[model samples]
Target: MMPCDSNMTSIVQRIARQALLTFRSPPRIGEEASKSFLENHSKLKSLMTEVRAADLHLVPRRASDSPPAVPVPPPVTYMHICETDQFSMGVFLLKSGASIPLHDHPGMHGMLKVMYGKVRISCFDRLQRSPQAAQPGALRRSVLRSTAEYTEDSDPCVLSPDRDNLHQIDAVDGPTAFMDILAPPYDPDDGRDCHYYRLLTDAEEGEHTEQREQKEKEVWLMEISQPPEFWCGGEPYPGPEVSL
Candidate 1:
């Protein structure tokens, strides 16, 4: 059923509540939450499904108002909402064809709910190896664990401390937006920082050919320098006023 305007207030309230509960004990990648939260607050997920990026007022605008003011692309823009020691909430809006590069949120948990349009999400896991299992200088291996498409109607995509922690999000065709919640957001001092990466050339498929191949099947990756063309423009948040 379509959520009504009247119910939106309640829904947002519930979301904030769940947000707090999640702070107490964040949800796992596959597991929604602790069994207790799952049992008692099952209605929370439904409410989340109803909320879209537009429903909230958060909006992105150019950091400056000057013309000849360098033209910034959507891929370069990122809008961060509230952040604290426990959790953080924000919304991201992307223009058609924009993308958030493949990056990793070290030791974090997150949920992304699409608000409009569609997004192609590619997720990966960094393979761990012992000293003897692999050579020192050899490029580290990364596995393409999964890939999924999300639209406004899709459920939130979940990520945990280690699994599927590395990912890239691309806006499909039209303008798209999504709500994001991160537990204990990126803190360089605390060691929860973000890092960008590129796929390592596959020995079997060859370099360029392997990168062009788009399949979920496990593939290797090597971190490379961040692309110079990529940059984000900043804007204001127009979403519901979050207090706390």
Candidate 2:
């Protein structure tokens, strides 16, 4: 049976319930979550750990399969599992050398779990601005929190409304796929819309390690139009159906 209650059988269905229970009433943005909410969040993370590619009926694709006879596929693909007023769940698949450019999740919480192959994620957090900083068009001062690679065996990557809210994801070694969950799904009227960005640097081409590690840990980023080379196509979720 579909996930009409707590009696869900599939891990996917179970994850949907746990996510629903965890995010349905999360504390407001920037506010501290109560103990109960924290506990539920932990459980949700644990459940996510138990998910796998086989569980979702997803198969990894070839590293580079561009046949002239075949329709050229988008660099990335998405398999939407479910969505509600509180959150959205889906899977992202990236082809070899494909990347999802740096983007922001305004006032949202998210979790990403690698299902097949590997992915490298570079995370950033906006920094406090000063009057003298750069009026450098669309640029926002920020700190690069982390740049790490993950595989199916790795635990889910976590993001909060205020921390590590911007990131770029690239498929590593080969094609990659990951399951993603976002709370309070994007709504333009609600002021939660997606934005793309790229790093703004003073140094050109192959500058030096100095740019990456100023010890100042600060960098400038400018918003940009969606990367022309990157586009996401949707696929049907072939796994067990989930419902709340």
TM-scores vs. true structure, each candidate: 0.75, 0.87
Instruction: Give per-residue lDDT, candidate 2, residue 9.
Output: 78
- Model 1: how far residue 93 lies from native, Å: 1.6
lDDT of 1 by residue, 81-197 (tens): 667677787777776677888888877877788877788999988766325422223354577877899998898887777777889999886667788878768898887767677
Kindly list the per-residue Cα lDDT of model 2 for residues 115-226, writing each as its tens digit. Answer: 9999999999987533442222476768889999999999999999888999999999989999999998989788787888888666621344354556565777877888
Name the best candidate (by TM-score). Answer: 2
- Count of backbone collisions within predicted model 1: 13
Mark the regions of model 1 whose C-alpha exceeds 4 Å error after superposition.
1-10, 27-33, 37-44, 58-70, 129-138, 203-216
Clashes per candidate, residues 3 or more apart or on different chains = 13, 0
Could you give me the TM-score of model 2 versus the true structure?
0.87
